[model samples]
Target: MSTFDDLDAFVATRRQAGLALSPDGARLVTTVAELAPDGTKPVTSLWEVDPTGEAPARRLTRSAAGESAAAFAPDGDLLFTSRRPDPTVEAGDDEPAALWVLPRHGGEARQILAPGDGITSFEVARDAGHVVVTTTVPVGPAPEPPEGTQDTDEAPDAAAALRAARKKAGVSARLHDRFPVRFWDHDLGPGRPQIRVHDQLAADRLTEPVAVVDPAGPTERVRESAISPDGTRLAVAVDVRDPGGASGATGDRGDPAAVRVRLELRPTGGGETEVVADEAGADHEMPVVTPDGRWLLWIREEHAAPGRAPAQSLQARELAGGGTRTVVEAGRWAIRSVTGAADPDVVLVVADEQGHAPVFRVSVADGSVTRLTASGAYGDVVASPEGGAVYAMRATMDAPPVPVRLDPHTADQEPAVLRGATEIDDVPGTLTEVHATAEDGTPLRAWLALPAGASERSPAPLLLWVHGGPYMSWNAWSWRWCPWLMVAQGYAVLLPDPRLSTGYGRGFTDPATGAWGGLPYTDLMTVTDAALERPDLDASRTAAMGGSFGGYMANWIAGHTDRFDAIVTHASIWHLDGFVGTTDGSYHWVRQWGDPITDRDRYDEHSPHRFAAAITTPMLVIHGDKDYRVPIGEGLRLWYDLQRHGVESQFLYFPDENHWVLKPGDAKLWYRTVFAFLAHHVLGEKWERPALV
Candidate 1:
């Protein structure tokens, strides 16, 4: 075995994902996921990063169940939600997560509050320490009466208990009247989401809770809510059903079935609700109030029609009961992770641009933008109240998410690494950026990583890796699609950002959804042609790979061109019409592809299945049965097509996996089989059977 061929090393890699900062900015916290003691499940734990890059990183919480959703309380306390067993109280096997607090002064972390169900998300007021939490409560019919049983004082409680028992006994079934019967990966109905606002008088106690946005029943759910900076009001995003009334996410009978999200404001202490900001054909979400509570900022995503590109704008409103709307950042560069930096008039926005996701400072006064930290994809910026220090989690194609400190106002400054518990082993490759131009003369950019010692004399074979999302940019490190593994075996992988990719301004991306088959496919080939132009890349021995939307593109590329020696498509789509109906969220595709029957022309023209008979290159298809987004049927059909046509193809099936092959064993096999397939096709070597089937 090669020195880097051990699967254990791949499984042992610690993953760091999210970041948070203390109110004073003295401490930076990040969530790190690693294998548990038994190496069975990945446990998420909070790690304290030295914001100033001085102190050694420390693990803040350690428990068997793990902790997540870290947030800072007003009085310098750290609050997180956990399902860890509390020794002070009896716990059940199916324990609902409860709120726990770790005092800033340092002491034992203890449970502060518990919800009837469990807390999904929460926001805390900076001044009053008020908390707003969202939870779900399934609505069930009252238990059937016991054959004309008489009403008693405990009848309601008895029936509720019986309903719970029935659910536990697998007798409960759900019937939905809503259009969105299913969401991403799960069914949506049978329960309604509630946003509750309440004040925590002291540790381990609460005064009372007020239903800021109460629901009539299970259908009217509340979402995207935040506690005001002063704890005096609440801002939330609620679904505004289409006036046409008969549509939603079910995509039933080819109806529009679209719903838009709007912003609403109500008193935190429970009072009148007002429409804070609502734009027609737009959804307003991710509301955040300024530290002074003078301005409220949120994201407004304008729904795009077929043959058009969707747009996102940073919308703002005056919270002083006045009426004025402002576009802080207008649909440019895919602004993300928007937060009020140390300067209230400016916000720290992480945007995808070129080949990186950099932090940008956007001025609220003039709409001018300035780039902050130089190179890397930044996430969740946190700044000191004094406007002096800023910390962000930076990632790149080569490095995983790592906390770093940078000047908030610096136009270009190197980020000082804030040491954390998670770190990567030495990368065995060289990373560089390349550029290309599409058939329409539009420029494209991608990150290309080549193995060590790869050069003109010993050119490395290429792997054209298409990113999923067809909208998301390839700016950050992805464990699922890590090129280092392929590079470790002497291959160069190209990560390109096609037209539908973000980080570019609206002009480059907004129109991309409508032209996916045209520009996205063209731009990908353009980048591939550019990469092959390099002296160190082998053009004839290249291959293409992708998952999800990338898988769709791979399928398309297979039918359109045999430029690559082979292709590997995972969690892919084979039939557009079938995908629109069977996918967990059918409404999403209709927005971009239109109704299949009503708009059959577009589907027929763009769907890859129509041209599958033209595929000549060998292919490898990978899929998970539990993948609801791209159903297993897509993979099954593609496999059958390849076999029926007598094409040299292999199918790697995963029954217990999802959209992603997440298990340690499964992940290892994924890399092993992919490399083996590439070795046989790209290098003209004998196919090596993987350790597992």
Candidate 2:
């Protein structure tokens, strides 16, 4: 059996993700994560892959603190962010992640920039070596304020000093006047996100940082940004709260106060910023400057309403004062990213189509779209500076992400995979698509992973694995919600893309917008029934598992049906009314289901907790206290409801983890516990608790 069957071995397997191509397209850099010695954390290191696929990949960097966000400088030097201690500077425990550069000619990697609180993300100019970095700066009033006034005019240049003073004085409170006081796992704090520019960077030291996009408060944040090829201008996507609501009302029904990501153009050197796109009810994000620096391209998505789902389109504007044009129409496919091509006339766009996220070339003059890659999902796309080839990290359900080279002109091309650090010899199962029809005659499809060697006489138990981001699809490989582990245990894992899933056009998602337990649930069931029709799958023995929105579906399944022998829900929302008000993005949820107070019928009908008394299946509830997206209260309340109703259930809680179990040790335990619970309920084995639980 492969490591996928063993929790410890699976956790130890080296994981490869992210890709960066050199300016000449001769070298490819990828980040490989390997379990640390303590087996608690996964440490990442940089590796170089030959773009030609002739040379075996070689390790480029190794450090205890790890390195990531790799990008290439205009001069071919490799730049990455790391928390590794600098040799020249005195080491400190509070050292943040700093920018480091590895010379292309050779020699040691030198620390270039180390600022307080470190950098989160950065971009390098293609024609110029200018660097733009995204970091956090301290905000809010000092410890003791006079009267009722605050230090609103605090200088951003003295942010480090202010932060140090606050820390030294043991004042850790953040007074927030925004709609959202917290995010996914952490509170919106004493510091907010800001972008800085480094016009001059050296090997020995970093230049004094110049704040370019300093937001007003914790509410506003830089969502995405890109630097021009000439390094003269910067395109940034900043998220800000809507003044009133989308319809200019006081956030009543049909109108909700939402935080939208708006596009802005600013000079690399300090100057007035220009608002490029700030339409109401829509978000403009993922700005990418064309290679020739003539056009700026980005994705514009409208906010979802009651019966309507969000619509996205690829939009472009001429940098030198021209009207914006729609390069691609809305509802064609869910656009993931846009990469500048060597020829600015044609850009490479990666989008979710059917079951795969393939690369497509779109004409800038016209909106003609052409598929480039045949299969698999791609990320970190880098076009060749000279124009023949494109490089990206490609991954399928059966394979982890690997560096691959693509032919820009070829359609449906099977890209040649470049040898990298992570490699898989064999998988525990085989992936096949299962198709069926919903009760309404709608076509439904799912990816089913069947374990090796299972006949009609000896069928494998089935596990229905629903994905989160009801808006997302099961098109790419996911480290957190992998199905291979369950497949390795002689169980068939069925990954379904239901009504709310992307890649199936816009109409498919509209049916499940405010109706969580309606079409999406039926679509899942329809696909699950199709998978069970196979002779190798045992329909009599089945289980359901999901996290986040998928977890909400799992809870819904538990109450609505008894088809499954066991259910596992992680970070699930039990009560709709409770969740919408408590979630990090309440405004977004309100847009979908409307006001829980005014729209009581919808909440009462769709809420999973309302039907909790009907659940008869054994369930394992898992939650992390730091998860503000779904919140731990939902899990605790669900556990209480299940126990009070005399339903067979167990709660697995993590105080340190967030929505996902990220730590290697914690992830191992999560799988072990799931495996044990399923073995007992679905396979009719004795109840055995996981060790260290």
Candidate 3:
């Protein structure tokens, strides 16, 4: 078949796989994001399809810049995060990101907050009277040292200088400028944002707004805060650096240099503080309180789990007794978030195991784990108040994500497909489950998507799509739509749940311990080799791609091997040496790399940038300008190094994007660039290259 025909066929295959049902299980939301006339951009939108076997879906949110995080408010109103127009603010500031409230049936959306600044998250309070939002507020300036103090002066002078500096800097005096003060409260009205009842700190108190909980040292400011369901207590996730460490050089891994997480609780009316849990070396995140306010559920990672690695287990603690218990023991795969179900006794957990995230239910009393859904990987599960049904997005290796519903009690766990992806047409393809033996002979599970109309004798080009969480797993369902787009282009996609991936238990994911590059890389290579042995995959035209930790792997693979024709690394860490000093999570990186100061050689050897000269394949580096996780500077460093070494390289930088592109239009553009790059290098297609320099 001609390349264009192959592309068309691939798109058709993806179309079939892109079908997704909506949260309520009554409508379908298609994957509509596709490359616009500008081959480097995609078209993303929210479409509604009737699941009652009716006509095609109707488009819901149609905009050049798409919408995300759509949910039904307590009163059945639709609340979604969008970057629509905000005439109140002038252009050139951050894009207007506000929570838009609309009717479930659909209509014009009213912007709740005047757009212009960044609104990281919003939740409709149980009463629906107010909306809880977490946002970034600018701090004025750094504090000056005490008037009479000098660096070489007496001890009293030094203390005075520090206090003066702290006073002038406000709460964020010591942190990097990018680390702004994060304020959380209720949206009392259209124009006013008030601090929540539980979050109010008495004025003039020495405690500041909130406490920082990083491992390296204390954050001069508060980073994140969440409220309990009863609205009586607030759980604040603080990132405090260790104060006893060396100042300039990267902190040691075991030395407790990174931000250590602590769970602190205070009454809604403002009372004395209580420390619920604190691990000297580990970080606790995504804290959620039970409906009865009896237990607190959160994800915690032992400081021992290296950079960007998954947590050891999900833990729960009783507020009264102060005892902790393991809720879910799938190690290495991080639990993203947990929500109290309609039934107060059961809680729904959304976790990524081996890159494949799914929802599971656990009994608060007995601690029994029940698999609520089937093999398809899913995410962002919104449980009904009744606890009988769950709303989530499901995807597989070859399918675009479809909204689905899971009924936990019955055998009818198969997700009812809600809508088909509208952007790309689906091509015919066969999805298969395979297991490859790792270098240590451990079986690694993977999902393989092959081009349709292929036989044992016919092999198509392969695209190895790795997941970001080195701790996550590749599930059976459709969670990402990008892989389907490539599959539609006649490329066989292989998603492996490698060692250190969740779902396989702690032993498998523990490979990340003290060895970041060794076992995980071996597992990936083993899986790739096994896929090549399949009759339907073309071994000669293989490509590699991933984001975050996956991006790190892509860079690592590109530099370590020449087996793949092309590579794309998104929001990935390149230079471990630079990362030690630059990124916000440098201390965490050091811990993962086993104390870079003590293991400097190992850190340098594992870093992708260290071996940049060996990357001969055409590479595409994609990163968001404001990405704080794997900062954009890392990508730039790799892009410049590749160019300097006379390698074919291109960098696509999204100006208003973060670690992951959230805007619909930005997401579409990102996927378009990815496919176009892959098509050009992997399929030898005639595609235009956007100027990167």
What is the Cα-based lDDT of residue 301 in candidate 3?
A: 68
Report the lDDT tens digits of candidate 3 across residue range 1-693.
532234333333322223332334444444455444444445555565554434656667767666665544444566666776754545443465766666656667666553224456654434322344555433333345547766554334332344445545573323432222221111111111223231221231112323222222223334455565545566766666643332223434434444566767766555677876776666677777665557777777665444334445677887555677877663534665677666766788766554356677878778777767656677655555545566666766545566666676553267765544433335357778777787667878788877675566777898888887665666644323345556657788888876667776667766565465778788889989988887777888899988988898898898889999999888888887776566655555556565556667777667888788887999998888777667778888988999999999888888877777755456555667777888889878898753333
Instruction: State the lDDT of candidate 2 residue by residue for 315-418, as single tens digits.
Output: 99988768899999987778888999997688999988888999999998898878998889998888998998998989998888888989888889999988
Name the top TM-score candidate: 2
Candidate 2: clashing pairs of residues: none
Clashes in each model (backbone N, CA, C under 3 Å)?
3, 0, 73
Worst 10 residues of 2 by lDDT: 247-256
For model 1, which pairs clash?
248-257, 309-510, 352-503
lDDT at residue 449 of model 1 (Cα atoms): 92
Give the higher-TM-score candidate: 1 or 2.
2
lDDT (Cα atoms) of all candidates against the true structure: 0.80, 0.86, 0.62
Give candidate 3's error at residue 168 in angstroms: 21
lDDT of 1 by residue, 84-196 (tens): 87678899777778888888999999887777577888888888888888877666666665565576753555434654766678964677765677664566755667787
lDDT of 2: 0.86
TM-score to native of every candidate shown: 0.94, 0.95, 0.72
Sorted on TM-score, best first, the list reads: 2, 1, 3
Candidate 1 similarity to native, TM-score: 0.94
